[model samples]
Target: MRMLLNIRIPHEPFNAFVRDGTIEEVMAKIPEAMKPEAAYFTEQSGGRGAILVINPDEPSQTPAFAEPWFLTFNADCEFRVVLLPEDLQKAGLEMLGSKWK
Candidate 1:
């Protein structure tokens, strides 16, 4: 399944990384290692943030995707399952809703 990884980096270690110039290396390496479908960097709640789209083969692989960011930047990571248009069509939402109703 596809997943959206909401990553929020706090200022402390992140700012230090940016200052020392390790952030450049990290930015290049981590994303390359993860091979995310997409990566968008932004600010969230007054802090550095990123949204990474990844498709992990197993739930157990979550840590593989999140750990480096957490360890390197003291980031907070949240994972949410996401559906593409085809996935939504496959979900049979109408049937489920009718049955539940």
Candidate 2:
């Protein structure tokens, strides 16, 4: 399944790493672990943040993807299932909705 990963890095250790010039070293390792289909770096709540689109081999594999962020950056991570237009078309929602009605 396709998953969206939102990583929110707290100010303390992340800012310290930035000031000490080690932020790049930390960032380089992060993507290597996930091999994200798409990745974006931006700020959230005045802190470092990232949004990653990933396809894990299995649902059980999510923890492995999140561990690096937690151990390295003390990041607050969230995972959400997502679908593309094709996926919605495949979902047969109209049939289910009619049954419910």
The prediction achieving the highest TM-score against the true structure is 1
Identify the runs in model 1 with alpha carbons over 4 angstroms from their true place. Answer: none
Q: Give, for candidate 2, the lowest lDDT window spanning 10 residues.
A: 25-34
What are the runs in model 2 whose C-alpha is more than 4 Å off?
none
- Model 2: what TM-score? 0.94
Tens digit of per-residue lDDT, candidate 1, span 66-91: 99998888889999999999999999
What is the Cα-based lDDT of residue 72 in candidate 2?
A: 84
Q: Per-residue lDDT tens digits of candidate 2, residues 1-101?
A: 99999999888788888999998988988898779999999999987899999999898999988999999888999999999999999999999999999
Task: State in Å the error of residue 60, model 1.
Answer: 0.6
The collision pairs in model 1 are none
lDDT against the true structure, each candidate: 0.94, 0.92
Q: Estimate each model's TM-score.
A: 0.96, 0.94
Tell me how far the alpha carbon of residue 37 in candidate 1 is from the true structure, in angstroms, after superposition. Answer: 0.1
